[model samples]
Target chain A: MRSKASPVSDRSKGQAGWGLKSAAWFGVLYLNLPILFIILYGFTTDDASYSFPPPGLTTQWFAVTWARADFWEALWLSVQVAFASMLIAMVLGTFAAAAMYRFKFFGKEAVTLLILLPIALPGIVTGISLRSAFSLGDVPFSYFTIVLGHATFCIVVVYNNAIARLRRSSPALIEASMDLGADTFQTFRHVILPNLATALLAGGMLAFALSFDEIIVTTFTAGQQETLPIWMFGELSRPRQRPVTNVAAIFVMIITFVPILAAYYLTRDTDDVAGSGK
Target chain B: MTTTGAARPRSLSNSFSTFLYQRPRLVLALLLVPPLLWLGIIYLGSLFTLLAQSFFSIDDFTAQTIYEPTLATYARLFTATNLSIIFRTLAMASVVTVISGIIAFPLAYYIARFASGRMKALFYVAVMLPLWSNYLVRVYAWKLILAKEGAIHWSINSLGLGPVLDWILTLPVVEGSSLSTSYIGTTLTFVYIWLPFMVLPIQAALERVPRSLLEASSDLGARPNETFRKVIFPLAIPGIAAGSIFTFSLTLGDYIIPQLIGSSRPFIGQAVYQFQGTAGDIPMAAAFAMVPIVIMAIYLAIAKRLGAFDAL
Candidate 1:
């Protein structure tokens, strides 16, 4: 009987059995192969076409990418858009989350639902709608339009994190600050801000990463502006310097990956970030 | 209590803070209004306007939009070509969703039940890192891998399986296409890109299933297989539902993968993009966009009923 209970405790252990582990390994490998292949092909000397084992390898593609003015402009634009959208999302999403968490108001559920809708709906739906609205309003397609499109979804990411953190932190903390002579701004600046600092950071990073890699929404809203991903899309189909594009792809992988890793570390212990979902 | 505060006047910001603190409702209103207006009015307003545009028709001769409210744009949707695009997209999305679900479940189950904390975190990274990486690059990589002169065929030839590779390429639906140039490649890439969505939700659901329940079933003289069938599988359905939502919706909305990897025929996303960008037909694009919106709305409603929201 004692032995049976012990086995049950070990039921969920890593060494539980081999079949489960092998199946899980296959799943992980399948997910990663494409990414790994991109990195591998980035080093290939065959620029005209991809071959499984490269005829040769060289470091020239990276240098070629470095010398491209268009790549730099696209990268810079993506950074600006990512930062702008992250700032907007952090401010608006944090405010909404803090307000919704602290006070119960009418139509609060509706407000939350509304925030979620942009991300919840298909990107094409959000994309065309914004494009239609822009054209209808006679707003020119520009950088501002792209930021607005990215911000719609970015706000949801920040709100999810901020609201989750706010819900978990006690109301007594805020009340006590006011009780101790801290005014509203001080209470928020001290108690609320500290409580929210990591979530906000996590949220902002995730939002930045999202905005950086965003395509569908940006496609409709970007007008003639080409963010890095948009540039990658065009270049893939009509690629002149193919390996340079792969090198640019490698660059994108690095840019988006760093923020995502940072966000993951910041929020790993808490399931508050938008895509964590569980 | 400050030395300069014999009878100091409060700063404007401090006074304002005090005032705001005194009225929580007012504070909430101030905090809430900006985001609400941004999302509600700006976003939903744009959406409503889009829906309105979908009902209008475009004038071909004038190259202008006719603003009168009508169902003329939607009427264009049932044209044989448009319907084929819609059906192709629907079939691909379902195929991707089902394939991803089947692959993800056992993997998620293993991570949820069998792995240690460190191993689980590693698996989470494995699942999420690709999702965070560039979407286009992944598709491009698959395009190369499935190319006629690419890795899969190369491997097949080296292994002395030359005829088998040719046979696959010559298969009826793929006669004019290789792996990278057909609907099959599109489905495979879609599944690859969206697999994390399936894995994470299912993992979350699996983790929530209690060991005690499994133990109870087995203690009652049930076999492990019986315990799993009766208890474990049913509990994980919502997670699978939640995951399917992402895979299905993403596949439906995606234009890039289809355009990059497949042949000339357009999916809903590509058609919408082309109509709006190339043809300068916003009304038609808006109408095409509505297909996914209507499908997703219905799908989400069903998902909510299946307890998917709880998992999310």
Candidate 2:
């Protein structure tokens, strides 16, 4: 009987048997193959077309990408937009989360549904809606318009993280601080902020990454301004400079990957803290 | 509290904090108003404006939007050509969602159950890395890989499976000179891009299943497959529902993949782009944009009843 129970525990580990393991690995391979292929093709020497095995290999495309002024300008614009959107989203999302956590209100669920709408609905709807609104209001499309579009969705991400963290942190801690002679500002600064620090960090990094790689909404909102993804979209139509584009693709992979990795690490252990036992 | 300092005047910041603390309603209002205004006015207001524009008609002579509320644009939307674009996008989105859900389940199950500690973390990062990476680059990489003179072709030729590959391309629905020039390529790319969205939600759902229940089922003389059929799958449905929403809506609204990799027939997204841009028809474009909004609204309503948003 003891042996039977041991086999049951070992054999049906979480009820995911051996067959599913290989299937999962296959799925992982499918997810990553194109990304790996992009890195591989980035080193190809042939500038004109892509083939399975390259005819030659060279480091020249790096130099060409380095020398291109347009690439730098596009990269800088994306950085600025991402930074501005992240800042705005962090502030607004945290405030909204705090309010929701502290009080019961009429129509709160509807507000949540509305907050989720920008990301929940299709991007084309959001894009065209904003574009039409801008035209109707006689607002010229500029860098600010792009940030507005990106921040609409970015706020959702930060709000989800902040609200989740706020819910997990015991409300009693805030009350305790006030009882100990700390004023509202001091309670928030000393007790709430430290508890929220990691979740906000994770949320902000994710928002930044999403904003940095955003293209569809940016397409409608960015009148004359070019972000890196928009630049890549244009470059796609021209096939002669394929390797340089691949180099730029690799650059994008690195820029977005670092922040995402940092975010994963920052929030991975948070489940154990902030009154999570409930 | 500076006990050493004799009767000092309170600073403005302290007094303000005290006032705010005393008035909870004011604090709540302060925290809530800015975001509410941004979302309520700027976001939903724009959506309403787009919906309103769809009801108007365009003037042919001057190429301006007529302010008179009419259904002329929607009447045009019911034309056979326009209807084809809408149906084509619907079919593509449905197929992509089903395929992504199927492909994501086992992987999600494995990650949720089999992997642990560092291995679990590694699987998570593996699933998320491509999702967080550049969207256009992944699409472009697929373009290169599926081209006539590309990796798939080379690999098939090397494996002596060239004839098989050629035969698949000759099928009526997927017919093309190469994979890159077919709707098949566009479908494949959509599934690839949205697969992670499906995986994460399903994994989260599967993780929430209690291990003791499985043990109890096994102890009751039930076979593993029987236990799974009766218990595991029903639990994962909400996650699959949540994930399908993403894959379906994204495919419905995407213009770039079909434009870059597939047949020339315009999907709903491309038609919207064209009507708004070169065709100089805002009413028509807004009308086209309403297709996805209406479909997703219905879809989300069904999913919400199934508790899909909770998984999200």
Candidate 3:
């Protein structure tokens, strides 16, 4: 009798366990359904209107999309912008973080606040302001301007990451190095750089991801040029490019997901790195 | 822990040697100059330009700038239509923030308190994935979901509730006869897009609430609700404020969702876009951008007063 009762209770527990599992599965599916639809429709024959259960399955859109030179060109431009902006962000952000970390300068707090302002402000504000400034300076919208505009906000991400990592580091290490024979450059290269390498790489990846998907700022700064997002925006607005646009969007989703996932993994072990200032 | 007195100069030569030892600081400062100059020339200078542009007006007939200082654009911003647009934008932003806050609090609590190490990391990654995808793609995906013959409508109809769904669709509360181009659609998209911002900060705050503190409260015979209200809520207010800043400011300045989903109504973002894109009125666009700046400034000031600058 005791054994039977235990079995009955175990069966009930099993049913309840399955119930929770199904619910969780359904929730995650609902969250990702839009992305699923985009991927599914990429292989569909319906070009005029996107139907829920796509009318017919076809892969011809992929071929057409691949054949288009404009697609490749836009993708290349986006890659260039993301890379350029990431490099600028890494160098600038590392130096700024080091300066603010090491010094007791006048207006330190004020300067830090100013550095964060562009990011905290709405992207539209940054976009419009940069556009206006570019026009005033008679700097025609080009790849350089786009990279410059992106770096303004991208630096904030890298700076935040680098500064957080710097804070996690013990000042005692540097002091100990100096107390020994090592000079400043030697100590930084040996001690600080190794400590910061993971964080800097993670920050750079994150900055690149942001620059890749950024549209509002790019829109104001790109002018007639088409980066991947800008090109997708145009494709989405027009009726003829719906299928091709879906393909392009899938491409973007894949590129963005990988780096961001890597970044999350790199930073996950260092939770205190995020809120160390407190 | 060495004080400045411990490092007091034994002689002028020792002081000079110390300066040479600290030369990396100077090099770091020098390396910082280029980026600082970039910010000053590009970001800060553009804000000055935006402020100056607002003083000029657009010519009515030709849609060209008059280039003369005037308050006419400010005067027009006060008109009934524009004021209503501003109010609607604010209302939408507030609604999104509140809805996201409510949903995020429970999820964030569950993850922070219940999940183990690996599960917690996976959940965090899931939350941030949507943020990395293209903004335009996300908005467009929402558009497809809310379209007349879309999955939402199809699912509702298939569930033997077609009449009820049809009636709701025909209501005046919806801007259009369909769901695609309406305020409801726009609000939903904003909530989904900004939800991650709300979750991350709240999770960070909740994680800081030590498990021992909760156990101690329970050991003292306090109920869970009592402990949550008395202990947890106060600690998490700063995180709530930071999350609200991101959600509110992002929603207010977003023109893309409104363009894609909003039918006839124009939010401030759309208004600014139109001034630049369609009307070619840069001054009017600059004036429109000031609305969010003022609101954000007030928010930042309050945040500073709360000593929440570090929260950001």
Candidate 4:
């Protein structure tokens, strides 16, 4: 859609110099080298050290990680937290988007700012604030606290995607539904939901990915409870657990990678909406 | 789409929907209240509590927080050692933001202008994967890569550039036993971690730039460099600023990378964590936490003035 806007500029396409391409590749290498090393070390035969050019490769760590009860527990806890957070975010984010889209209100800018604050501010502030808030309220640090912490930021992810998609979708679709004598529930169920499905799915997946791998906020909110990232942190502190930690890192990468990829594809063609560009 | 039976009698849900339809204000309230209760009351209330806590002082003998408001904690924050931690974190955040912008620009430009169709999606996913990869693992990977007997050291030695690395490591402020123990290593890790945050926004902003604008620039007697300077660069500023917000604030508040990989000197985050966790001085930690908040508030104000939030 963009490239077709001006054919003259299209002539200049593919003219990116070798320097720029190599620079981009360098950026790619910079991003992935550490990740590659994580995978490499996961298969490393030596367990005690990160000696480069590992003496040999083996599958021992995978078996060891599989047998570890704590690893499984952490992974389960992370999954539950991510799912809960994502669900809360999806519900509240959708409501926020609907209100903002359908009505005019004073202090809307302030509300938007408030919504964005959790993510816009540093994680440390959110962590410590939530920690203090819970303690002051005499609330114990538990699964619920971690989910609450995760949901605050996760809401922003879903809200951004939902609002963007709402803006892209035409209001006429709802008007038409109403004109055809559909009630609010029917219009929402039949019209608004279909338009929002992919956006919500993408947002939910991103939210899950975020809550799954989150460490900083989890540190404050989780009391004696290990999420996968926190588990990885503990493992990193122990030299003997290096290989097993790397294997767990591989598990995290695969878990998050799938959702992120799904989100990318779900949102890639969002311009092609059911009632857009009308 | 499935059409409902028009002859069917209206159900309870339909009548309730009708009631809501007649009251748009009610509908709006219903839509807004839940999210507002969470964000406004819960999240903002917590923040307010933290700010209020910062104003209170801790008792030395009892090790308990005195409810009375005072600036003593803020005063404690300015002691020489504490001030150094503040400065160190600010310095690192600034440097990381700058370096991330430099490295992210060309790659973002390539993705924005050159890559198309499947290639574009591939590049986009490639950049995004690292961001979603476990944050702890990425930092730990860098720790291994920068360790004394790590991959970088081994590679440098294999290339017979061992002396060069050693020489580089021995430089004034950056000097340490190895890369992993220096500010340089921490800075590098910070850049790698935040690079994707910098790239994505720039790419989005650049993608939104209509090709016709570039055609107009070229047709208006502007050279390639002039067109880039006057048009492309100006359009990308919002994105760069937005990206800097993440890179700067994240680095400023992060305690983990420094804890695992850098010099033993504490950053603001480590200070906050330790003051609150080990020292059990909540007042001190709250006061220290305000440093990044204050810095970011100023940073965000400027970025907002530059229309960075639109890019975000």
**Top model by lDDT, which number?**
4
Give one digit per residue, the lDDT tens place, for model 2 in B188-274.
999999999999999998988887788888789889788889888888889999998899888999998899899898999999999
lDDT of 2 by residue, A1-278 (tens): 76767666555565455678788988999999888788888889877888878887888899999999999999999999999999999999998899888899898999888888998888888999999999999999999999999999999989998998888778778888777767678888999999999999889999999999999999999899999999999988896978889999989989999999998888888887735544
Q: Judge the docking of candidate 1 as incorrect, acceptable, medium or high.
A: medium
Error of 4 at B78 (Å): 0.8
- In model 1, pairs of residues that clash are none
Better-scoring candidate (DockQ), 1 or 3: 1
Ranking by TM-score: 4, 2, 1, 3
lDDT by residue for model 3 (A93-183), tens: 8878988887787778777877898878899999998887788679989999999999999998888889988888778777777676455
Kindly provide the TM-score of model 2 when superposed on the true structure, using C-alpha atoms. 0.95
Off by over 4 Å in 4: A1-6, B1-11
Q: Alpha carbon lDDT of residue B173, candidate 3?
A: 59
Relative to the unseen true structure, what is the C-alpha lDDT of residue A249 in candidate 1, on a scale of 0 to 100? 86
For candidate 4 chain A, which ten residues in a row score worst on lDDT? A5-14
Supply fnat for every model shown: 0.77, 0.74, 0.47, 0.80
DockQ values, each candidate: 0.61, 0.62, 0.35, 0.72
lDDT of 1 by residue, B86-197 (tens): 9988988999999999889889998888777688889889998987777787888898898877888788889999888678777876654567887677778898899999
For candidate 3, the per-residue lDDT at A240 reads 75
TM-score per candidate, in order? 0.93, 0.95, 0.89, 0.96
Against the true structure, candidate 4 reaches a TM-score of 0.96
Estimate candidate 3's alpha-carbon lDDT, on a 0 to 1 scale.
0.80
lDDT of 1 by residue, A157-244 (tens): 9998898888777777777777776767788789888768998998999899999989989998988999999988878766456788
Off by over 4 Å in 1: A1-14, A175-181, A270-278, B1-18
Worst 10 residues of 1 chain B by lDDT: B1-10
Candidate 1 residue A31 C-alpha distance from true site, Å: 1.2
Clashing pairs in 3: none
